[model samples]
Target chain A: MIRVDENPEDPQTVNELIEILSIQLNEPVMKSTARLMIIISLALNKKLTFTDLLEITSLGKGSLSNHLDKLKEGGLINIKTVFSGMGPRVLIEITREGMLAYENYSKILKKLLSH
Target chain B: MKETPMDLSDHLKKVGKEVVRLDFYLLKRAFGVYYATWAAAIFTLTILSYISGITEQSDTYLTLYGLLDIGVIIVAVDYTRIVFRKAHMLSRLESDLQMSKSFKTIGNNVNIGILIVLIVMFAIIGTNIFPGDLNSLLTFIILWIVDLYVYMVTRISFGKVQPEVILAVGTFGFSNTASCLEFLLTGNSVYSFPLWLVTVIGWSISSLYSFYKAGEIHSTEIGESGSRFS
Candidate 1:
């Protein structure tokens, strides 16, 4: 039976982990967990309603709208309003850029966890 | 700048936990809408059947029922489309994350369960095995089981007890269960159409309550993690 250690104390391994962490920490959008979550959700869902995002994030409307605007400005997401019998609803879709970002983050996180 | 590898690992784990929490929260809410829609369909059908039988106006009931059936179908199809689209999006992801697999599994199982239950319920009704008009009682029993099953699934999957869902559905189920027990005790036509109608309305109200509770979560900012931007 093999026992798994929590954090390998090898100097090189630690340095490598630290370097990966540092690189990710330098990214502005990746600095915040909230933004990362939004991207992950949008990436996985492609598109979701504003209310659906609100429910997912558990954030206030104003704050969520602000995050959406930032994502839109970053070319990570697009926000649109469509009208139906139930009235107009906002739809948030992840852009190709956003999906790429999500993929990168997920890869980094998985690598970090493995170490 | 002085963070150790262990510290960074903890941070990454925290973020991952928060993301998973939010995803599960969204899923639970979606299930609420699903349950409400199904309850509405069942309630509407029950009411239509009762009205047609009482009024003896087959023509008007047929027209109204046909239109309502169409409406229900449209709504259900719309929900199916949304769910499928989301699943497709997840499938398109390059990395085979464990979280994604869990999400897809839950989605597939829930939907498949719905189809199976619908088909079985329809089959039972079509058979008309009961001697008298006790078939309606079977429908109520099935609905009660649905409520209990939902409660069980939510508890098992999310690891949190949704008391409101259980409470609302429980009240209706309790009343109907009592009705069934009473009928069983005395071999009589006590399970009348009016009683079934009342139980159907109760179930509908319970569904509305579930919808209200589910929708209520998003209206306000919850927890510090939710308000990180603010």
Candidate 2:
């Protein structure tokens, strides 16, 4: 929702910004803010319970499952069922590929903001 | 398939806030349990040591103080283990390096503390470096120094000086150090500023505060229940 009306005076800087945006947009999971928020939480915490993720993203169960499926299909995360006294619980953890992707996104964002 | 309406910079800023929030939540839970444990240990053990001293049971008093030192070190190492397991479970969080170093630092500190305590115990029991009259005072000073060192290392590990820690350090540090100084100068123990009272009051307050903080943290919802980030 934030609008950046003032482009950088330097042509090269504008080009760099456009390139960063394009790169982010091309990534299927990275392009969505919801998935990025989930990734950020996972990347920082390593593993989180399904309830933890639910509280974090505030997404509905079905919608959250869809996002998780996309993230799983992209090989960015792994989901495993854990049985406890309460019952079966889903635990999600970020993969190495997911971590790298998060790092790349972070670096690109930092680079863009610096301009 | 759905594009974010926000720009890249906005996305980063928003996600960054969530990251910090999650990090704080996990640490708060871990340290809440830690503070509560220490509160119980200090309150009970200090009272026992005080009783042993008043009963003229010199051996029991010394043993209790030694146990307190060892017990505290065990707690410190246990906390490190908890954090280590959390880090290992997460696999590759950005804070892993700092946590690994904290484990080593806490390990080295515990070893050094134990070595010092053992040497002091040997000198007290076997050698004449410390007179019989000074046995209790010496133990107090040693325990004070050990507590202070542990507090410093804990502060470094946690990256912030929590209120529970400050309360403990202030209470034990002042009471023990002042008692030793008063005994050294006046040749008599300060009955009015007894360690048992100080510990009971200090740890009671600390435990209450820590439990309250923990309760507050658990009550706060991390995010709105139905609002989607997208």
Candidate 3:
């Protein structure tokens, strides 16, 4: 295969290189709509609750609940439950790992523009 | 107690949209890192060859270079397979979305770190900055093992064991061992085969053991979270 630097500015070559890079950096968690929105919101807010996530994203109860579970399992978000007067309410926060992934994703977006 | 049909449909549509957006974000990130690394590797190799005058035009050198090129191509193909597999898993989660948040977050972070390390390795090797010595080989092996371990831990924690994760671990193991053997065959005495071989074997064994342990943890918590959601 021709090396990348040989024709770095060639549009076709650049496109191929971009294609390969896209494959390597793609994250499974980032592909879910609910997860992405929650991540963006969490990044903006630093922390939120399940109800807050639902209200912000306008996701239904089942969809929000299911996506939140997946995000939690993936370590993208953290849930801290506290007992209030009525019942236990959970506060969701993006973990350090999640923030890193978000940052990485943001970096990728910047690259695409430069390319 | 009951959700209207329109409500359910609207909810599913929203979920689908979220999945698409996430896919776009991931694809962009993966491609960006990959291209930058490729460009840097090629540039470094070209510069090193020019400086060292190491381009011995012998038949033996040409044959060995061809073999190395083939090996790299194989690795690239395997990497593509991994990318596709992860993409497929994400698509499935769009519908099921049953995976754990912690696992996904951890997996993404690990993936990014590994890619960065890989780019660095490519640059270092291409530049011939670090001779193929025992210390360098040991560092490569240690990093490979760590990457595999992190991958396995993420998989087990997520409760969704995609074949891609196992494939990645296996591929990294095979490549690391093969590279070491290649060094040995080249008569490089910088590394002791006995010690490096043992380290590789130990890491491989421990990685598998941890994988099983992770599986157990996942199974235990499978349905436990469902009740909380309800």
Candidate 4:
């Protein structure tokens, strides 16, 4: 929290605040629009597979995998990989941490911007 | 801070709503398919009615409906196929979700009660329509009851509220309302045939759309999560 005496409305203060908020976001949740989309999409639907996400997000192979790795590393989601007749299937499920982070992020964003 | 901060509550609200919307993605798509099927069904019925000489109605309108219905059903199917062929993942997701426990949930006691009530209401209307012909009335009632079950099953195939299902239900409601009015007015000449035409059209579209989508979904390979995206 920035001190009121420090002029919360200052550009520097706002930039710092933005940075702070960005840092607080879940590892898989921040900066990239695709990451946020992934989290939001997972939060909305409890579970999704690679193909499902591919169809929904229209994200390419490398980009989706990169975001998934970050999310997976941050303990935001669980990625399960296995084989099927069509080839490989990757299922992505949002963890409780990821869900809470997403909800909190949405709330905080609304709060920050609502003024 | 100088300029008034843009109010984004509405935008936030929209984003929040998008989550809900995404949740119903497959359902909405399924609805388009439903409309296509309903058109085909109505066309078929009109042709059959015309052939049997069941009513003194204009054969031209009925024949026109058949042609239009067939055309629309074919187009909707092709559109669905085109968009969804590469996106087989969507079809799989829809089918898997539909086959899940939610589909079975509708078969419980409460729905059955509602089903019974609907059956009774339609039966009264059917009986009134056929007048002294008890056999025809019975047949009409039985057929409607079967259709009601189909309607319910189709509606719940993917946890309800597929756009197609809603349209189909609305169509049914329209026809029934017309039937009730017809019963009050004269109750003798199948005055609700027009409404029935609308009803079958709606169902045929709903049915074909749902069927193909579900069919596509079922075609996907299902097993352990694959290494590719799992």
Candidate 5:
């Protein structure tokens, strides 16, 4: 029942860390690592266009499309469309689950790397 | 199975740098447009002074302006292309980043302030410039139209912008307006220390409006490499 914030070296912290490690290591969610990075990056922004992702990731259209579709299907991200005078623009934003997954992934990654 | 050739840490650093580069590139582009537009304005005024016979006796001024025009035109074309093709992009990026100090209204505010300066200029100098009262009024109207043209061109090249673009553009607007106001204030008809004080007050009004909002001044960040020229 120890809060992770309240105590650093409590046995509960180790148990919770181990549980987090196992969930991250074994879960099908965010297994690709690239997808994890996508979520993490999106977490840092309010929203990103397909073009933004393309520039930041340097991934080709087809490859980026495949990843985006998978993320959308997994409910980790949402692809919304808006119409401008020029044309329709697609905006990608991370969902709550995506944000939580990223936060968890980052915490675990930081802890593991620090060790 | 998807490829996992690289580590997340490496990807983070690599992506991080690319975004940083893009941010700096955009900041530089915005600043470039602001400056180029200023140069264009100078060229315009030189043409005006020459046409109006104000600088008729000043060959040196003409030659200097002509040389400066050459450089300004060259620089302006590149900056114009970058800015016109990419209006509002900088604001969008800052919005995406959820930057708290984003000065979204500064561009519009600055524009309004400059228009005020033009209005004051018309009030003070309209009679001398146009000679006849009716001609003066007509000239004032033309001035409004021309100012709008210049302002819109500058706006399209760099408006609804945020972060350093807003700061740079807004500062340019104030300085341009202030200097122009100073010319009017220091005109022989009303030239005096009191008017100079009014000019300083005029500058403070525009500058304080632009920089003091957004809760805290991020002009400090304007110098950050994120604030660095491209």
Candidate 6:
């Protein structure tokens, strides 16, 4: 049998092992459906509105609004109100915190994909 | 072959339904912006007119202002009705987001254009490009152009009734700037160029703050998936 070392300090083996561990740690949080929805929506456009989210996800108004509220509260989105001909409209955009979360999540996903 | 034709029809029907839904959502989102802007414009104009002595309680000026006020109110109420009628079909937050983004983009472009023209008008007046009477006439012409441009752009961009909301707010700023400058140049009023400069500085600072805030918000929503907050 080929010689094998069980020591965690084995450089090549340790690196691989650490990478595997990282993937496991990152996957569940980043890969969650709610996170995915937000990520996909923002990725497709630099901004998303409530109605746009509904169109993209085909989710009901209340459900989508709840998700948006959670995202906003989580510091994952920013909403602004502007006047139009019809009424006061809310514009939803992503925030730096949201971007960081997505980035970290993506790194985890990448690690998972690579392994 | 029979199955293929039927499947295509079903797909088309689904698409048709989706389009209708999207249209409704867009209308409501647009309406929200309209009402807010209208209210803001009226409030700002009333205050500015009072401060500038334009509201001297003259019959003509008062009548003119009253008519303008009534017009905006009518527009706002009518647009609100239209939006509410279609609101039920919207049933989606994302749709509103998309419409809002489009409106913001259009608004930014229009705002930039208005600022540029105002700057040009100021430069021309300062340099005596035309006599006083002609200058006033030219100013009116520019105002009309600005109004027309804002109306056309908002209507085209929103694809519904024209929302004069943004135009109203912008017009307030433009008028304020012009009136203040005119007062400084002609009346040598207490309000100096420095004050005007300060106003510009204030605008620039606030604008930057808003932009930074928007960037921060955008990044958070995107969450590293290269997503954009709408």
Of candidates 2 and 1, the better by TM-score:
1
Clashes per model (N, Cα, C within 3 A): 0, 0, 31, 21, 0, 54
| Weakest 10 consecutive residues of candidate 5 chain B by summed lDDT | B221-230
Off by over 4 Å in 3: A1-115, B1-10, B13-64, B67-101, B134-139, B142-158, B161-230
Residue B43 in model 5: lDDT = 42
Location of the lowest summed lDDT over 10 successive residues in candidate 1 chain B: B90-99
Rank the candidate models, highest lDDT first.
2, 1, 4, 3, 5, 6
Chain B in candidate 5 has what TM-score? Answer: 0.33
Q: Candidate 4 iRMS, in Å?
A: 12.4
**iRMSD per model?**
5.4, 6.8, 15.5, 12.4, 11.1, 17.0
Off by over 4 Å in 4: A1-30, A82-88, B1-27, B30-166, B171-204, B207-230
- Candidate 5, residues A13-106, lDDT tens digits: the string is 4236535533532333323334544565576553678876665455667877888887777677899998889799999988886766655644
Give the Å shift of residue B110 in candidate 4: 20
Query: For model 5, how does the per-residue alpha-carbon lDDT over B1-230 read when each residue is reduced to its tens digit?
Result: 43232343344334333343343333343444444464444445445444534435577776876676567655655554554324333343332233233343354345446656765765666356545544534443444454453445344333343344444334444544544465455532212233233333433443344334321323233223221111
> For this target, which candidate reaches the highest TM-score against the unseen true structure?
1
TM-scores, all candidates, are: 0.56, 0.52, 0.32, 0.39, 0.35, 0.32
Task: Write the candidate numbers in order of decreasing DockQ.
Answer: 1, 2, 4, 5, 3, 6
- Tell me the DockQ of each model, to 2 decimals: 0.25, 0.18, 0.03, 0.05, 0.03, 0.02
Supply candidate 6's per-residue lDDT for A71.
71
Best by DockQ: 1
Question: Candidate 3: interface RMSD in Å?
Answer: 15.5
lDDT per residue as tens, model 6, B15-45: 3233433333344344445445444444544
lDDT for model 3: 0.48
| Model 6 docking category | incorrect
- What is the alpha-carbon lDDT of model 5 when measured against the actual structure? 0.47
- Which pairs clash (backbone N, Cα, C closer than 3 Å) in model 2? none
Lowest lDDT block of 10, candidate 1 chain A: A1-10
